[model samples]
Each structure stands twice: as C-alpha cells, then as structure tokens.
Target: MNPHTLHAPRAPGDIRQHPTGAARLGPELLLAVAAERLRAARPELAARADLTTPQGLLDARAALTADEEGDPAGSPLVVAVIGRFDLPRWVAETCRFALALPREPAATWRRAFTRTVFLAGRPDNLTERFTFDHMAEDGSTAWAGPAPQETTTALRRLLKTLDASRELSAWSPVTVEVPGAPPEGAARPPVHRDLCIATARVTVSQLLVQVNHLLVEAVLDQLIAPGDRLTLRAVPRLTGPAVPFAALRVDADPRRAHQLRAYAGLTEEI
Candidate 1:
C-alpha cells in the first residue's frame, strides 16, 4: 500500500485521524462544509453540480492532490466548468462559502480549491514572490526566505490585531478581462465577448497570517461541533469572528507562474 494512502478507522460523523491516506481528513470535511454553504447560496447551481456528492468532492480533491506523474491542474472537470460557465461568479461564490465554514475545514477547502484554480484555470497568472530578506536592517540582498515557524508566529501576532466577527464583504480575485472579436464562422446576431481571467499572489507567510487569524476567531466562536468530536471554548480577549472572513489578494506575477515556486520552494505541479 502507498504510505500516503494509509487508512485509519473512522467514527460516526468523523472523517479520519491521520493526515495521510485515502481516508485523509481534509477532503470530505472540506466538502461537507463548502457544500453546505453552496447549497444555501446557489441552490439551483448546487443542485446540478457534482460537488453535492461525496464522491464528486473526492474526485475534485484528487484532481488537486494528484502527483506529478498525473495530469496537470487543468483537470477535465475544471476545464468543463471554466469553458461553459461563469467562472468568476463560481469562484467568488465558492470562496464566500468557504469563509462561512469553520476555520480549519474552511482553510483546507480554500487551499485545495486555490491550488486547483492556480493549476487548472489560472496557472500562468498566479505568482508568489518572497521579500522578507529585504527587510533586514543591513539591507543586504540575501535569499532568507520566511520560515514556517516564523510565519506562524507572525500570524498569531497579527490575529490579535483583527477585530472579532469581521464582516463578510466584497472580496473577489483580481481579474483582467480580454475582449475578443467575433469568430469568423459566427452566424448573424452572434456576440463578441471578453474572457474573464482571475489571479492572486500572496506570500506563504501572509496566507499563514490570514489563516491563523481566522482560526483564532473560529476557536472563539466554538465553531467546532459535537459531531466533529471536538470541544473548544471561547477565550476572553480572543472572541473570534461571528461572521465570515473576507478574501484578500497578494502580489504576484503578471505573466507566468514561475517566481512563486522559487520563492516558496513549492513542489506541486501548480
């Protein structure tokens, strides 16, 4: 058996205990949360989308988590949606729904789908550039990247600064629309239109900070439930968000997706 696919018996309403394996906890947990929000926000679309099924969500997660030997992020399902539907609206709504979930599951859902978005629909557009080295007092140009521990610490610090229950506001991907002329084979009354391109660029550290802030808030709100087999208490001075967190954008590449992998040392095909 593949080491990464190790299995652990799960309890009722519980997903799994380990991060590895075919029964890894993140995928279905994320699906249950996101699906709940999507069903409420867009019942008509949600009714038709494959995301309504656990297997469908598993397939979507598989698309994002596939190894290098597998297909690129541009999975057939993603291509189908992007080509035939209003991709921007879908992505915006999905992100909105993700923020509405409890922080842990919400973050997992966002990260997974964000990877899918970067790999499949927006590979050439999303970019990450690390810049912490420049913050050194000596101003020497060294490649001192942000450490994961340091990023987490910074996030915790920033979380204290955010007010509880930050309102859910309009936060959409930075988009560029390119207009195209009518096709040569177009019949009468055909409409020429624009392509909606979306992208985001934020350092891993910044993402960590945002995630940590939301996690703190989730804990304060007692977001975890009895069905999740977890108990949490609301802490004084740390009362978390009563509302959803807004999505934010970070700096990225204008044309290609190369700089981000180098800055973050990411190995994913995305």
Candidate 2:
C-alpha cells in the first residue's frame, strides 16, 4: 500500500497534446511563457523583499533556457516562487498554466487548478519549493510533483472551506516562542520555555510580507544554497485513509541522507 514506491512513467489519465510544426515550442520558451504570465498576473509580487526577487526569477528562467544541461530531471531548477500568504485564486490559476510546461495542456491545467485549491487551506507560513522540468524536444515535460487521487480530493475540500471563510483585513500575529532572554540580575532559567511575546495584528498584505521573511529564513536554513546541483524522485507515502500522495525526494548525493533531511525541513509547511 506504499504510495511513493510506484512510479507511473505516465499517469493513466494522461492525454498528451502534440503541437504541430509551428505550434511546437522549446522547453525554454514554454517556461518563459509561464514566467511572464506569472509576472503579468502579479506585478506587485515583484517588490516583496522576502519572496524571490525579480532578479532571482530572471536567473531561474535563464537556467531553464540554457543548453548546457543534459538531463531535464537532473537539473531541478526553481520555476515558481511561493511565500507564506495565500495567493489570489486568479493568480494561482494562472500559475497552473505555467507549471503545466506545455504537456497534456488540458489535464495539466486542471491538475494545477486542483493543486492550487489544495494549497489554499495550508498555513500561511508554509515554505514552498517549486522546481522545474526541462523542456523536451516535443515541448512536453513531466509534472513537478505527484498527484494522488485522495490527496487531490482532500485539498479540494480544504480550498472550498478557505474560500468560504471571511477574509479579515487584518489578523492577530502568528508567533513562536524561543528561549527567554533572562533578566541580567536573575539566574538563567533551567528550562528555556519561558519567553515573552504578544501577537501583533497584521493586515492581509502585511501578513504576506511577514510570511515571505519566514520563508526566506527557512529556505536558507533548510535548503542547499541555490545553484547547488540536485536530483529528485517521487517518494510515495500514505497521507490519509487509502490516500496515496507522491512526495518528492531531493538530494545532492543519493548516498548521503543529510541533504535529504535538509530538503525535507525546507519544504515542511509551518
């Protein structure tokens, strides 16, 4: 019943779209299109310091288009930049098209929509990892992540709930306690649990900014520095009752589990 063990070279439901002569595009072009669309949809996202900057975005696209790399699977480049706050429904939908990478255009689009919905309910402080697949000669590429049926449905429900919830103009701050800074005169407490904090109210936009900062810190701590070569595989794991979710396993060296642990920490939401 292990889900990650199975690798469907092709998803059973896949119905690929083959673009003819003029219609056919290179992988780089397809990625470029995806990136441009994302930029157009959310020009405001560009200014956020905590999230991937416009410069970082350009670098990712340049890497995708570069001819030097051999295997598409080997060069797992960052395609999309997600931060802590939730994305607008329209923007998230647009991103799906970008992630589709010119394959199964219809199905990939649908899957992207489903995935976006699933993400809506997740904690705002979640760290995101968006890697890209190289463009094949035919302009088709594999999905960035696995999509199991049960997980998809679960996400759909979660998205619906999130959509229905009233969006506040502001919310109480989300904070985590760390070891206390002891008073100079007092002996350092034996246990570090005691600390001082009060939640700060933040507007929706402010919340996104805060999350972006958290994401940046988390990635720096957990992920290998950007441009460090890496590899990935679909690792199946049971997420719920009879639900199979294909988790990604990334490594700088397959023989070393340390990097994998770091990758896991980076991708952990909240």
Candidate 3:
C-alpha cells in the first residue's frame, strides 16, 4: 500500500470473482493484468514509473511496441485489439490470448468486448479448463467457429442495441441487403455485394472501455507487474480494492483447479 512499493514484487493474487458467481472480473482487474504482462513484456519501462492505470497500461504497451518497431517513442501506439469479443468463447479467448503472450501487445488501444458475453453466460463459468483449439498457425487469434444460433442471435441483438444506443460515429461502413443485383445487366455476381460494417461491433464495445475507465491504469499497474506471471484461472483476493479485484479470481477455473494449482507451482496451503 506504500507509493515506493510500485515496482516491488508480490505473490500473484486472484484476478476474477464476485458474489454472484460467473460474474465479470472487475474492470480494474483487466487493467491490472494487462499492465503486469505488458510491463513484463517490456521490463525496461516496468522498472520505472507507475503505470497502474488503464491509460498507463495503454501507454506502457504502446511504448514497448514502438520501441520494438523502431517508430518514434514519444507518441503513443495508435493500434487496437479490434474484433468480436462478446461471445462466450471469445470472452475466454481474449483474456487468455493477451495474458499468455510472450511478446509486446499488438495495439495500444486494446479493448476486449464482453457486452454480448456478459449477456450470454456467467463470467465465472468461463474457465481456463475450457481449452481453446488453435485457429491460426501464429496463435494470435483463436480457432473458435461460429457459436450456436441461439448464441449468435444473442450476440447480434446485443451488438445492435449497444450500437443504436451509443450512436457511435460510422467508424465502419457496412452493406445491408442490396435491393436487386440479379437480373438486368450483371455480368457476374455483384462484386460489391454488401458493405462491411465499419467497426459497428467495435464501436459498440464501449462497455468494456467504460468499465476500465473507472480504474484507469494507476490501480492496474499495482495488480500486474513485470516479474508476476498469471494465467486464466480466478483466485481469491489477498488484498486491494473491493472491486476491480472483486469478481476476478487470479485463476478462475473450477474443473481444472488441480491442473491450475500444479501449473502455478503452488500448494493448497501457502
């Protein structure tokens, strides 16, 4: 709890959990984890300055990526982890992907979507034991196929409501259904069949961004640090704010509790 202890090391704490069970991890927790992995990924910066806020995490990740890519260091990285993340499977995958990475983050504005996800399943129900088969050879993205129609519809609706309510700018250009592309003089199938929805799904993902905005990076930097490495399982909190750390267990896996315990190299009793 002291200020100078910013860079000090401590035992990894549980990152997810709440009274309601399967609840979403506190927004602060996400910022914390991102900070820890990101700082560790770039030890040079982690050793200095308190990046315990979401902005701090963003700044730290941006700095590291810029340093690696040979771009100017003064400015922040203008990148984002843009994709559909509200699906149950995606929710699990997003957390797992970023945390397990051995390299710097791909973007500075990384926002993991979970509106649809939270609407769909119990957050705690999401677990590390749920193995994600690799979809890409590089492993940057997961190989999860489309979820069941019920799941898909829920996501679609969630996205629509969030989008319409937010009235976010048309950052994305989307093509609905074209009227008549069949008869007249179409040499081939309509080349421009439908327009791509310009970040519609993405724009509506403010739920996550807003969630983290509360904690920012100041708190996050404390939870996650360079030397500390954690995975997807949720754990009980040893200390810190009620939330951000609440609803988030360090490792939130129930079925694989034994597997996780072994992996962390921790005994039941400490």
Among these predictions, the greatest lDDT belongs to 3
Which is the better candidate, 1 or 3, if ranked by TM-score? 3
lDDT score, candidate 2, position 174? 30
Q: Which lDDT value does model 2 have at 194?
A: 9
Off by over 4 Å in 2: 1-150, 161-270
Span of 10 residues, lowest total lDDT, candidate 3: 261-270
Better of 2 and 3 by TM-score: 3
| Model 1 poorest 10 in a row by lDDT | 261-270
- Model 1 lDDT, residue 132, Cα: 28
How much is the lDDT of residue 154 in candidate 2?
30
Writing each residue's lDDT as its tens digit, candidate 3 over 82-138 gives 233432233233333333432322223222111112232222222243333222222
Off by over 4 Å in 1: 1-26, 40-45, 52-270
Work out the TM-score per prediction: 0.20, 0.19, 0.26
**Candidate-wise lDDT, in order:** 0.26, 0.25, 0.29
The residue-by-residue lDDT of candidate 2 on 6-120, one tens digit each, is 1111222111222221112233222332233334323443233121233444443344334213443332222222222332322222223333334443233222221222133
Evaluated against the true structure, the overall lDDT of model 1 is 0.26
